[model samples]
Every structure is written in structure tokens, then in C-alpha cells.
Target: MKLEQVSETTWAIVDASTYGNVGCIKLPKSVIVIDTGMTPPLAKKFRKLIHKEVGEPITDVILTHYHSDHVFGTQVFQDCTLIASSAMAAIYPELLNNRWSPEGIQELKEYYVQNDPAFAEQLKDLRIITPTQTFEDSMTLGKENEVHIQHTGGHTAGHSTVYLNTERVLFAGDLVFCQQYPYAGDQTNNPLEWMRAFEEILKMPVEIIVPGHGPLCGKEEIQIQLAYFKKLETWIKAQLSEEISLEKVLQTVDSSPTPPYDLKADPRLKFSIERWYTFYSQDEG
Candidate 1:
């Protein structure tokens, strides 16, 4: 767990490497948390850190999206108000029943333990909680230290982001993947929608973009990710024009947006390609 003070009132807590990041800002009366960490223990650690820095109690836990990595820690902030997009709220029941059940969460924790023991230990005392407040398009909080939460659907149907109106900082959620491979698979995952979200982001008066994963970044990462998606689209279109089979497309299309990274071998990368291929192929038809 690494924390950086972006400003006197704003801070970013970056998890180990590619894990989801959390953001917090000090308001006149309380601290506003963007997202809890991936698990209870990690969220507890972040909660403690924020209390120490802000010297105030958390007033709200604003969820960026419904992904387990972002919202699974909701249990720790028990007393604080929980907030999320209406779209996310609409899907929470489904996610809880199908994806985030105790068995499902335990399986994911075990997988993480297999991959990295240190990170998985945070899964201990796991408790799942849902948002009590939700909005459709956008919402605002604070009088002096204002923050804006906007619905930006790209990564998911209900995906949203946080904007510090005064600080000019954007907690971009998964709308922008700084250095990690973007997991572009979900019932609502659409690369085009994701790109459109970026266009909207470009117009915002933001200087720093703390991505959902990877390190804290700037706008240039948005450009690079956009380029990646564009290249991916072009590659898929060319393959379709050749009348190639899906398997052949998988075989020939270069999945890596940059060199030396064999993204084709990564499961998330494969899922992303398959999802994009299916969507574009149907749209082209």
C-alpha cells in the first residue's frame, strides 16, 4: 500500500503495482473517499491512514463502479454513507447473487493467494456491502471543497468517476488504464463507449488522473490507451475484411499495443480481444 499526497487536501493510495487505487480528499468537515481497496484489511489500512492525515471521520464512501476490486471493501466503512451510480445500484443485486457471493469471493481470494500471498491476506475478514445512495448522471458534494461524481459508461454500464472541482484532479476509475492491461470484458463493456468516455474526460479541467489501476498518471496515458484501442479496432477490421475466421484473427492480430509485452498470452488480454472482436464483427455486419 503506497499513499501520495497530491495536494494538501487531496491524496492517492496506490495498491501494490497493478491493483486498484483509492483516492481521498479533505473537506471542510469530513473526508470523502473515492473507492475502498480490493479487500477489507486493505480498506481498513486506508481508512486508518485517511483518519490520521485528515484528522476527521469519513463522511462518504463513493464507489467508482461495481467491480469487486473497487467495492468489496465497503464493509469497513460501516458507519459512513455509501454512494454509487444508479446504474451500478441497479446491477448490485445481480452481482451479489452471481458474482460476489461468499463462495465466489473466496475462490477469487484463493486465486490471489496463489498468485501473491501478501496481497491476498487482505481478503481476511471479508465483508460485502452495497451503496445506500445512488445517482444517474452526476452528483456533487461539499460546499467549500467541492467534488463531482459523474457517470462515465465505458468500462462498465454503470462506471463512474470522481472529479475534484477545485483541485482540477480526476479520479478516472477504469475509464483509463495507466500502465496495466485494461480488462475490457463485461456485459456492458464496449471499447467505443470507453473511447467516448475518454473524449469527455479530455474536455474536463483536470490536471492529474489517478487511474483505477497502475500508478497515478496524467492525460497522456489517456492518449496512449486511446491509441491502443484504435490500433486494436484497425487490426480487427483488417482481419474481418480478409474474411478470416475468429481463430485466425486471434492467431494473426497483434494484441500488444506496444512491444516486448506479449499481451496475447494474458487471460485478460485474450478476453478483451475476444470481446472487441465479437462486438466489432457484429456491428460491421
Candidate 2:
């Protein structure tokens, strides 16, 4: 909910510990939103803040990926042009029909209400909103390379990262988890490609980075994240030779090849290990 102005035209909600970082950029005539918050109420609050403080109506909302935390709040911005990767757009129907269906959303509300009764009313009338615009590779907004959106899949098949050409600020989405552990278990994720994306990022002259779920950082944090994944891949490859059950593999990984990064209380170590194990196991098989 806290906003920090990164540059003259860029501002970010740096409180990813509370929710995914939402941001807005000033264009020639209007503002472009980076990612909406995880829920309707949160998104509404962000929309109102942009208008109140930024003094510009949101003309476009560029989603980094299709993760519910990033895209689920798009309904509030239905009036704006919603943009995403073609891969993310392709999965919208399935997400709407199953994962983000009204029934599925209601179930989530019920689970949260069990812990906090006041959450029930806040989740009312929640619905999925798919992107209206999509691109296969890269897209530019405004003139002279001010804003650039490029499809960079590693976190997910359709994930995209935004780059501000003039400022050298990259909105890395889930590709860079900053100081925290990243979720690496999605069926669409490509860990090797994700690592390659890191190398590409290092090559860039990004002065500031806005990660999907962490604080504002620089290239060193990206290096740490890359190192973490490499260590994970090495552990998975080492275990691929063992003729053990998946559960046993999980247990063994849980105990050894200690993760190279700082683990939050809810670290994705088991999930990352399982995902890499499955990926490598298929190759070995």
C-alpha cells in the first residue's frame, strides 16, 4: 500500500510483503498500471489512489502474468485496456471456468472467513476478468521506447517483464523473487529458461528492479535468485540417479542440499524440489 516514486514517471507500491507490488507510470496523457492487487477491494483502493494522487485516469493495465494475485483484480479495471501475453490470454478461459470460477472464489472466501469472519463480505461479487489485449513477443507503449513489455517465460509459460527504457527500471514479475524464495512448481514453468532469463537480466543496465513479490532491488538480488535455482537443479540432478519413490525423494531433498537463499517461514523449498525432481525424472525416464 506504500508508494515510492522510482523516477519522474515511475512509482511503485513497494509493500510486496503485504501483497504483490502494484505500480503506475505516467505517460503523455494518462497513466498505465503495472499489476493490480490480489483482490477486488485491494484493486479498487489502488485505482482510487492513482486517480487521487497521480491525477490521471488509468488508460491501460499491463499484467505481468496470469497468476491470480496479479490478474484476479482486473475486474475493477474493466474500463481500462487490459494487456497480457498471448500465452496468458490463451489460459484465461480455463482459469475462468475452473480456478477462478464464482464457486471456486466463494470456496476461497469461506476458507479465509474461517480465520477472520469479516472477510466474507469483502469477497462478495468477485469474478474473473481476462485481458482484452495480448502480444506474442514484445510491445511498446508511448513514443521513443519509454515503456516496453516483453514476454519472458520462466516463472510461467506466459510471464512478461516490463522495462522502462529511459530509466533502466525493470518490472521483473515473478522472474525475480528478490530476497524471498520463489514458487517453481507450476506445470508451465521452465526452470532452465528462468535461469537463462537471469543471465539476460544481468546483461541489462537496470538500475532498479521491481520484482513481483519482493522489495525494490538491483542485480545482486537477481544473482542470488539465479544461484538458488542452480543449486536446486544440481540437487535434483544428483537425486535423479536414485531409484526412490517421489515421496522419498521429497523427504531426502527436504533434509539435504540446503537451499542457498534465505528461507521465509513459508519457503517454497519442498515445492521447488518436487518440481525440479519431476522435470529431471521425466528426462531420465
Best by TM-score: 2
Which window of ten consecutive residues has the lowest lDDT sum in model 1?
255-264
Candidate 1 TM-score versus the reference = 0.88
Worst lDDT window (10 residues) for model 2? 258-267
Candidate 1 lDDT by residue in tens digits, 1-285: 667898668888765522578888888888889888677877788888787776687889899888877877789887999999999899878867876778877887899889988877877678778899989899999995378899887898888999897878899988876777778877678777788888888887779888898777888888777877788778777777777888876665454354113345556776777777787888832
Name the runs in model 2 displaced over 4 angstroms.
264-267
lDDT of 1 at 189: 80
lDDT of 2 by residue, 30-112 (tens): 89999887778888887777777786878989999888777767889999999999987898788768867887777888887
lDDT of all the models against the reference? 0.79, 0.80
Per-residue error for 27 in candidate 2, Å, reads 1.1
Please give the lDDT score at residue 98 for candidate 1. Answer: 70
